[model samples]
Target: MRIISLISACLISTAASAEYIRGSDYGFKLWEGAAYTDDESGQFSHCVVSAPYKSGDTLLISFSKDKTLIVGVANDDFNFDINKNIPVTIYVDRRQPIYATAIPVSSTMVTLSMPNFDQAMHYIQMGRTMKIDGRQFSGIYDLTGTKVALERTYSCAASYYDYASAPVQPDAPVQQEGLSKTALFQVATNMITSIDVSDAKYLSEAEIENLGFGAASVFWQSDDLGILAGTLTAHRPTGDLRATDSQDLALMSDFCEGDFASSSQKVSHVEGVSQRELRGICRLDDSETQIITTKTDIGEHTLYNIVFFLNTEKAGEVKRAEATGNIAIHAASYAIE
Candidate 1:
């Protein structure tokens, strides 16, 4: 499925005041068929990649300047009320259905916003097909080139946002021979800001030091959710030495005092960096705690650990996807400084 004349029609109808800018190709039949800018201000508004099916329906995926992801559908034969919101369920392969609200942009086009961006991207990249079920319309679309398309879209956003050129403070300490407290604090602060932690309150440097958890630690507590998350960096001189399961258990034991029963463990890589993630339950008498820890090698014989301790009683209320997503962002954002 490739986009044709429908791309122009979809974009023009979706946003009347937007003008098409340059086009970009992401390979494998995925192209930025509609890169739009505001007609009045001449600024980038959004970029879209689309696929048209034999049924005359076109599937569109777009990324806005404000970092909103939208999945929309366009059909010439469809006639819908503009600005109407409809409830819909999206199913990717055999994964659980995502319930979302679709807003009609035009009489023939409707868009749905993804609530869980990481999960949605994962499903689209790994799945073969996506089915949208709604009261007004339903269809299944092939997801062949979505993985590369999404990667390119993310790259486009990063370049447009100038993330690579983001300035680091000149006085920020750098990690050279050993772990520096100032460097760790700066890295932790950058990680927190990058992840956009607006709901939690972070502990001060004095408070963190008073806790006796060592100098290379940053802790944030969400009192409303009863969750404690922190990062710990340690200097380990074992170059290129991959920790075994027993060694991982021993390391986890240092962070979790109670008897730990490992529920799952896996190694994930992002942007050439590999991280070992472990999730388990800690039990001591009548109390239980859920712990998630990710260990990543940040070059120069340094290991960075992100640990999350969740209250077992409020575990269901906590957004585990967001937590794990933050860990991934941290893994990708952290440098040896």
Candidate 2:
């Protein structure tokens, strides 16, 4: 791992040059180093550089993780110390949620929400571009470390409505338990944001996916019950490549308890099926929320993950789906879109 101050590092362009991964957007990996990591809290946090630049430049922001925010810059890591006497309102990340603004200097205190927006906002254009030290970013890549490209359009996203029929409260936090080692390893890498399935898309009529795979995304938008979105991709592992993912809306609607044995009863009969030795469930208000990711070598097993959502108005528990040993890899958290 290499760390250089903005003044000492290699300077490059600021288009969209992150090489190892695409999109320096928040909740993603940029360049080659670690883009996702675990802090003291169980919550997954991600950091990506806007484009390597100086402190004098502007940093674009966006929304994510329900109401989480993304604030990227073109400089090295550092802390900003503003006078408390000036002005104060919780500065959000344009992508996250915040209780109330405060006058503090710390990572946790920094709100990820810029001002508005959530996971469902889909109107993409450009928005406000504030300075690193409170000015406008000249849109230049001041530093270089793999030539991360600078962004041209800044965006904000969110969606909401009268959420009354929700099986679960939209904003309620779910308790995470029974995290599998595979899932834990993924969570440590902040892979949760990358798990998704596809609705099947063909890239070429003359050709099929090398191994029948592609890309997908799950954003803050609820499927009316929860949050999920699936798609097909022509991109997947080819050779000895190894990866793990967590699909948010991998749903299995209904199944008879008698369909499986007691040994297979990993969760509630109505909560769908879980195979691996590990699984978790959360009770959110009158509804239930669950998260499970694991691996095993044996016979067939069925697991389900549901994102029962109605647009962005209501939420419900997601059903789980059983997976194949190889296909379960899609459950990994680092697959690219």
lDDT of 1 by residue, 1-337 (tens): 1342344334434444555442222223533343455555555655666777888888777776778776678888888887578888889988999887777777887777667867886898778999989888788888976765665555444333321111337897653443355655665565455444556777885665443343346677765555666666543334442543344444345445578787445555465665667676778877877667666666643345454555666556556657565665565455423
What does candidate 2's lDDT look like per residue over 18-52, in tens digits?
12112112211222221221222222223223333
Query: TM-score for model 1?
Result: 0.42
Global lDDT scores for all candidate models = 0.59, 0.25
* Candidate 2 Cα misplacement greater than 4 A, ranges: 1-35, 41-43, 47-49, 54-67, 72-114, 117-337
TM-score of 2: 0.24
Which candidate number would show the highest lDDT if scored against the true structure? 1
